[model samples]
Every structure is written in C-alpha cells, then in structure tokens.
Target: MSKRLFTTQIKLLESNPNIEHVSERAISYKPEFKLHAVQAYKSGRAPMQIFLEAGFSCYR
Candidate 1:
C-alpha cells in the first residue's frame, strides 16, 4: 500500500523553494535540490538533516 500526504503536509511542502510540485500523494523536488541533496549525502550529512535543511519537516 502507498501512503498519502495530508493536506497540511502538502501545504508545508509546497511552500519550500526546493519543491517543484506537491500533491496529495506525490512530491516533486527540483533538479538542483536533488543534486545538492546527493552532494550533502556524500559529504556525510545525515538524511534527516538534509531534508530539514531543504525545508522539509519530520512531522507525520
């Protein structure tokens, strides 16, 4: 089964600059953001830290 995002989560994600698009069940991040995330990961940054730095929340 696939999990879908709540309305509030969608709104929050939409407000982030790194997000290109957001829907109830899908979030599309920008290409530049993807590259940055990869680089950050290779540099030993934590996954959660990368997401937080990109304006994403951990709330569920």
Candidate 2:
C-alpha cells in the first residue's frame, strides 16, 4: 500500500470509537498480514472486507 493511504487508514482506525485501540503490539506480529490487508484495499477491495477475510484465514 502507498504510505499515504496506509497513514489514512491508521488515522481512521485510531479515531474510531468502535475500534477501541489501534496499538502497534496488537498488529505487530502480523506485518505480512497487515501488508496484505493494505494491498487488498489499495487494489480496490474494502479494508474491512479484506481484513475479515484475512483474519479468518489466519485463524484457520
């Protein structure tokens, strides 16, 4: 993902009341997964949509 969009998403996540917290530690271990999420979003997929897909795949 481009730095601009990634920064935007992070800011959105951080500001969302529903998100609770956007901590580095929570997401740090899955850098590759996060990258995939970002790329998916950049490629036209919705971030939340890709996130759910990736999150489920990670558990399985």
Total clashing pairs for each candidate: 0, 0
Q: Which ranges of candidate 2 are over 4 A from the true structure?
A: 1-29, 56-60
Each candidate: what lDDT? 0.86, 0.51
Most accurate candidate by TM-score: 1
How far residue 25's Cα lies from its native spot in candidate 1, in Å, is 1.1
Per residue, candidate 1 scores C-alpha lDDT tens digits across 1-60 of 577666678777778999999878788999999999999999999999999988787858
lDDT of 2 by residue, 1-60 (tens): 322333335554554333444543332324666577678888999866875664332221
TM-score of each: 0.83, 0.41
Candidate 2 local lDDT, residue 37 = 68
